[model samples]
Target: MFFILDMFILAGIFGFLYGFLLQKADFCFTASLRDWISVRDSRIGKGVLVLIATAMIGWGIVLTLGLATVGEVWSMPIGFSNLIGGVLFGIGMTIAGSCASGALYRAGMGYIQFWIVIASMMIGNLLFALVYDPWASDYVMEPLQLAEGGFTLFQLNLPFLLIPLVIVALMLFIAFRQFGWSGVWQGAKDSLQDFKGNPFTKSHWDIRFVAVLLGIIATIQFVVMSSISITGPETRIAGVLLSFVFGDDFVYQNTYLNGMFADFPTIGLGPEETLVIFMIVGAFVSAILSKSFRIRKPKLARMPYAVGGGLLMGISSRMAPGCNIANVIPGIGGLSISSLIVVIGMAVGVFIATAYIFKMPLLLFQKMDFDDSGS
Candidate 1:
């Protein structure tokens, strides 16, 4: 019992940290993607890339020493599941205006619309129950599954060090050509300097600080919870409700359902659920502390998109057998082929949704985060 309590407490701490930092950084996968897609803003994307690189380094070190809870790389299976789900997820994020993590944290910031968005996500998860046996099994997922063990980085013993090394080299190469050694030295100095006042209580941290810290948190989460995703549990709330209505045995008909909730919580206290729940709580507290909490009424016109997008998010997250963060942070970090497919599918989905449905710009090659004149 105490051990369980300890795990929950740890998860709560991690969730709080994530929520606080995410809110401060205004980091959302959807926002990052949309900014790049609609207007070519790469500020958030660059931070996310840094976060992925950091997680790769951190998890790689932990895995190398066999310190992670799971003994091996927790690579997802290579299948159409990731591809199909990723596309759907990307569309959902665009529609809903936030990914699962972003919505949770934003909901914490007192967005009334996202609270509904959160509930809609649950509905989306249960909706999958209806499709799992009928069409998804033989037609959509199984026959389309291309590989059993995902094309994993572990298969080739790929070193995690390569990510940081390459990133450094790339940055230096750009900096040298642009600003020379003086600029590179200035960048290094700026990065290494300590934050003023209490770093923990402040908002608007550097993208690098936020990215590296988030990576550390992700590594800790993997080691502590042994779960690949927060989205899995977020959506599993629907599963728990599904089991409640259909009974566990009936719901267990789907193998994916069975595996996802193998240790289904009895008192709503599983490590996975606890983490997400506290994440919301943590974000709320962060918002309150930062005086950023304000109830923004959701526009009625946007509600349908939130509902539809959320449902799609729920379904696709499971379909991809991953989430936005999974595909980016750990997914890329682990170098899983399935993750790569999902990433591509998501980009495609975003392209379709943003360009066609919403009539957003499709300026793919435009220089992001540049001045209006592209200077």
Candidate 2:
């Protein structure tokens, strides 16, 4: 019990730090994608690449050193669900202007719309549960009713780890040529100083600096928790919420829930749920310290978009068997094929959603600045 308590404490600390960094940087994956796709600004997008590269490298070292086992890492399997789920996830995030974790942190920052989004996410998950019996065969894999036909890249016999390493090396070279090592070193120095000072209101760290740190933090989460997932906790929390409406015995009728949430023979809350709960608390603490917590009412016109986006995200998260964190971090770190497919699908979804949202004609060059007021 003390060991579990220790893990929970560690998870909370990690969550707090992550929440602090995310709030300080105002980093949203959707915002980054919108910037890259709509206005052609790739600074945050490039930072994301750096984050991925750093994480890939870190996970490679961990794997090579045998610091983590096969069961310790979360790798999505090869499946069409990844592609389909990514499309829905991308579309939802673009519409809502926040991904799952983004919504959580922003909710902590007192965004009423994100709170509504969170509620809608629970609704989406519950709705999925009600319909899962008929739905899993078409979109999800299972060991119960369905025979899953997919495998992770790590399960392959070839030199799959080298692919991520080589790609990371190439990205490092490109980064060195573009930004130089001295700039990064200087940025790190400035970042540490900023961390020690007034990071809430005033920050001097480059996004790249934060990006690299985020990569390292992500790797740490994997090493400590066996795997990192943002949506798993969401699902578990949603399940807990639904248990109030329908008893646990009745809710577990959805076999998918049985497998995913059940640690042994039971389905209930644990460290994973605590991690996300603390994530929200951490974000709240950050907002309080930063004086950024304000209950801003949602725009009347955008409420539907928020709810709709939340529904899409929740539904797709289960379908993909993961979310942005699931696919973008450890999944990619482990060189999972499903994650790669999901990335392609998400890119395509973002392009289509952003274009439609902006009412932009694809054939024409766009000079209008990306508007985030709706978010």
In order, what lDDT does every prediction score? 0.75, 0.74
Cα lDDT tens digits, model 2, 281-351, are 87787788767788889899999999999998888887776778668777777666777777777777788
TM-score per candidate, chains pooled: 0.87, 0.86
* Residues 228-329, model 1: lDDT tens digits: 466777766767777677787766776656666666544233776777888788888877876778889989999999999988888888788777877777
Alpha-carbon lDDT of model 2 = 0.74
Task: Give the C-alpha lDDT of model 1.
Answer: 0.75
Counting clashing residue pairs in each candidate, in order, gives 0, 0
Model 1 regions lying over 4 Å from their true place? 1-3, 69-71, 158-194, 198-203, 244-250, 253-255, 265-269, 362-375
